[model samples]
Target: MNSPRLAPPTTWFRMGLHRYLGWEQAVTLAANRLSGFRPVRAVFATASRLGDGIGWYAILLGLAWHDGLVAFQPVGWMLGTALVGLLLYGAIKKLTARPRPCAVCDGIRLSVHPLDKYSFPSGHTLHAVNFSLQLTAYAPELAWLVVPFALLVAASRMVLGLHYLSDVLAGALLGGLLAMLALLAQ
Candidate 1:
């Protein structure tokens, strides 16, 4: 028998991915393919920064402050999910220790920089999805605006070559689920 396995499914699934995916080849392909697009890079860079922690949080807090109790309650849920997403995705990144695409591929046009090293789950996307989805839960009217930003932020991770497509996808799923969990906890 194979002696043992830890994180068996994760390992096998990653291993089984054809050579062009979730690894160096894909990063190279994506970077080389995306590197020439200055316009896309610029847009994604702005979206990344605007959707990131300080940017989005400022908007939420500003809404809370301006709108009085009406906005405060939903902002509360948004903040709660942000906290839960922070802890949850932080742990997953630590555990996965996946390298940022920048570490391996150079063909991508660099735009906004990342704050951390690992790349299994895009932290920006995590917060983006978490905050926006939770906004829908407690602040429905704002969802139309926030949801589109969330999608752009997710795409930005890949466009910047800060993450693989899978990383963005995983972050989206994690964030959505965790946001729901946070709401249920309340």
Candidate 2:
């Protein structure tokens, strides 16, 4: 009997991509130069929070008044993504004991406080992908916006030296799978 293949070429490719992304020279350049646009980064960060807030409001409205249309589209997407994101985050953290890039790689440094836990799957990347997937489901017309932003968030994690490329890929896959499963459940 043949043993199951674990960590295939795609996995290796992703790992290599992660290394390239986590290279200190590029990260330092982005952190020192591109990050100077504080306003833009702040806006992007706040968008994620706002998305969560919208999800909460929708849930409250749905339970209190039994109305699913309050903020309708955006809220629905937000709620769906949040549910999957939270569940997958727990699973990834428990299953993968990989450390954050900054923790394991001497070649990379973080621009912010280092996370002290497994990094095989990035929570931020998961959340971003979930949001993008949900948005795509809700509004097919916005495919162009949703796809690129999702990719950008995943890339940014590695560029920021917070997560490896493999971590982001795992996160993206898990997040997307969770969203699909949720839809099937309903």
Instruction: Using TM-score, give the best candidate's number.
Output: 1
Clashing pairs in 2: 18-165
| TM-score on alpha carbons, each prediction | 0.80, 0.59
Over 4 Å off, model 1: 1-15, 19-28
> Per-residue lDDT for 132-176 in model 1, tens only?
877777668877788888888888888777888788888989888
**Model 2, runs deviating above 4 Å:** 1-81, 114-116
Over 1-186, each residue of candidate 2 has an lDDT whose tens digit, in order, gives: 998878989999999877786574355345434334666455444443433345334433543355346546455556766776777676768877777766766666455453446777777667666666655665566568667666656665665556666677778887777667655654
* Span of 10 residues, lowest total lDDT, candidate 2: 47-56
Instruction: Report model 1's TM-score to 2 decimal places.
Output: 0.80
Write down the lDDT of every candidate, Cα atoms only.
0.78, 0.61
Give candidate 2's TM-score: 0.59
